[model samples]
Target: MVAKRRQFITDSILLASSAVAFPHVAGAAQSKRIKIGQIGTAHAHASGKMSAIRSLPEIFEVVGIVEPDKERRKKAESAAAYQGLTFLEQDQLLNTPGLAAVAVETEIEQLTPTAIQCLKAGMHVHVDKPAGTTMTECHALHDEATRQGKTVQMGYMLRYNPAFELLFQVIRDGWLGNLTELSGTMGKYANDATRKQLAAFPGGGMFELACHLIDAMVTVLGKPDQVTPYAFRSHPEKDTFADNQLATFHYPNLVATIRCNHIDPFGGPRRAFEVAGEAGLFQIQPLEPGKVRLGLTQPHGPFKKGFQNVPVRKTTGRYDDEFRDLAKIARGEKELAWDSKHDLAVHEAVLLASGMPIN
Candidate 1:
């Protein structure tokens, strides 16, 4: 009888242990997955982002890819980046079982529309850069997302950049007191073929490239009272090339410039922006985060000094940071940053700058 009692107690303890273990085992399986879908391979940056999604097994599961263009699909498959991934039809990709979100890396013209479809279908969206050609499209898309209670994170990857974060803090802290002048350059080396391709694009360089700087400018200076755009087609007779262009924005107490061109050479360093105020100046170099240099007037000094490097909190590549942030928001860890309202403002800027009629 004593031996029987001992066996019963041992069995009860073992059952209790298993009860505890089962939840963890189940949780491990749950935590191992984040069903991510890629909904286009039209953007130049798509492959890089796709590869990153594939490599991070603990955080993501590349459930499917949606490729509309056969050429692009072939290229994606040939590229080592998409070796083991399955490409699905658009409808199938959108309706995939347990699909959490879709990355809209389509052509610039298709970005806003495709994103709208994804969000309407109860999936979160990760749109590529220069969200849309016109602001109205962006606004309509974001409004629908708001109504659906879904997220639409625009592809302004640099905002997640660490240096820009510090710059934001400094600007807000008045470290650069009463910012007066802001200037940014969006330029890159372009061959004949690239230039021709860009020339075919309307609004030329401003819409295609300068949007980044313009967005950043709006971020730093708020909405401007008046905008005087200086668009020029430098090689008008040669091709539909609006190579050199500028947008001069006038704010309450600030003036900003956006310079865009395809006149630079390859392998050359690209310049981002310089914000100057009465107290100090901040410079952000392209593709390098946490490299913000701030130049402040000594508490009491007459001499003008050069910029001194300021400490910027480091952040990892945007693909990881953005996804992690979105996941955290989804998991009730924090609030979403690029909310519907914020996206509306961004879209408004894109439209206003594009000279598109705002609705």
Candidate 2:
């Protein structure tokens, strides 16, 4: 078991090393690719991300997949998502040559450790949300990642969505002056399969689901002064997991609320975010299909308020924006928008809201 684990890590590390495009080397004139590795196949989203990487031939190469669990390994191998990908033992994965970075898409319990291992190896890491179970571990991993000069990107998918892009632009442009409050909701039908998959985690919906909103909240507004959570087991018999969760994060300048529940109807409101400012408000509904409503109030002249529906710019692919952004960072052409501190702060808020002990 120990040898197998070591081999998996080695292969993951090697696959993460990107081939250099030195000026003097022939055939190096082509654009360099960011070689990314995947750790653990337990995460359902891992396969989706792998497919996205595969589709983006210009940005990334899906090199190695590390699935330590026997059952998960078999399932991942047979899954269409794993087609045309190399599978390796953990140590072999870590030692893979020409590797650039690793995506820590393991079970929630393994997210932090896997990311730490990648960062300690002097490689960038993209970790899934609700980073870790404990605040101390989250901070420790973040600090180590920083010390090693690695980027620890938290997987907050909404940040890269096009509708939110316009909202953020309006706020930054000062069109919406003195933002005071913001609220966002991510609702999905937590069917039997989802319930079974999420039952493995402890914090239920708050940790498993709501972290996406919390991260978005922090992105639009800075860290909250206090985060108060009101959670419940809405479906006691459905599964051991907490099905209903809400957290109100307070800021001196603004107040934010994140609502997540496992009971949304199949075709109910998909996801939405509303930010209100002294001047006006901005809202995005059913974030997937991209419906945006932007309202602005007049400043000095005759008071006026109007709404405009901004057309949604189609994204190239699933999380493709994020992968391309990371490639830019690797090439020293872009600064890390999502930093380690932001992740620690977001996770800290989640832990606090859950009434979990924090360090």
Candidate 3:
């Protein structure tokens, strides 16, 4: 039995390694490709998301890109990601015939506004994370999309992560019992330029990065009653950026802490999410190329009572399954996994956790 388990683990690791090397081929068969347009390239993940859309030739057809800022357009044009794409004015892109959706990849402050315009234009929208700097705007966008029956997909990448997907299932199955505590951290070393950019926002690294983990936590724990945040500058020499921050979400029975910092020596590997419950504990470290560790009070399914490493399929890339899910939702083949109400709640909690004013 021990030998069989070892062999199975080895085989799973080898398969995941191959998947990392080669992108996952999505089996989306649509009569016509979803005509997708992109708005803005200011967001850091814009190019990467666009590249993912382009890679899935069978699912999406990039109609055009809208960049009102001339300098931003000029700068993006030289990049390989935007080399072959056509640039159009906002109205032109919104009015494009057969445009099914738009990826609102704009600056953090512009995300909600751009998404609102796209929603008003009768198109599904894939707005990037940290929906916006304000909850009111985020709620308006989500509410409008809900009324229009349009899909408003927030680009919270972990929703599609294989390990996270499994963790969700495990929790739903009651394998983890009643959740008592959850903790996560997403931090990295930043250069001076990055520090300067982050310092512009009061939330600093927490707003820029911790929002991702907060989204995941809300998915797992639901909305918390109170959010207490602690913002600190671990390295004042660097800049005024709130380089280190921690936010605690308080629930009746659970307390969750999410920490983000700018000075972890090996931040990538240290990024993690841990859930502790009466029945067991589940943790995933280095969220990308995710590795899951599980502990249980009693034997369950194929897992032993003690801690054991579990194998999850590696992602092709960050946005591989994200785009795939978007295609399915656009094609009316699948309902959005994360609906607007959930998104609004998550965004509200995120703002509070980031030490931003709700009103």
Q: What's each prediction's TM-score?
A: 0.83, 0.86, 0.90
Winner by lDDT: 3
How displaced is residue 346 in candidate 3, in Å?
A: 1.1
Q: lDDT score, residue 158, model 2?
A: 74
The candidate 1 region of ten consecutive residues with least summed lDDT is: 12-21
For residue 19, model 2's alpha carbon misses the true position, in angstroms, by 22
State the lDDT of candidate 3 residue by residue for 1-359, as single tens digits. 32243233334333333333454432424568889999999998999999889988877889999888989999999998888889999999999999999999998889998899998999999999888888788889888898888999888888777787777767766788888899999999988888888899988888888888988887777778899999998777767888888999998887899999887778888999999999999999979888999999989899999899999876657897777777767877656656666687788888888888876
- Judged by TM-score, which candidate is best? 3
Tens-digit per-residue lDDT, 222-255, candidate 1: 5667766666666667787777767777777767
Clashing pairs in 3: none
How would you order the candidates by TM-score, starting with the best? 3, 2, 1
Model 3 stretches astray by more than 4 angstroms:
1-29
Query: Candidate 2 has what TM-score?
Result: 0.86
Model 2 scores what on Cα lDDT? 0.72
Q: Model 2: which ten-residue window has the lowest total lDDT?
A: 14-23
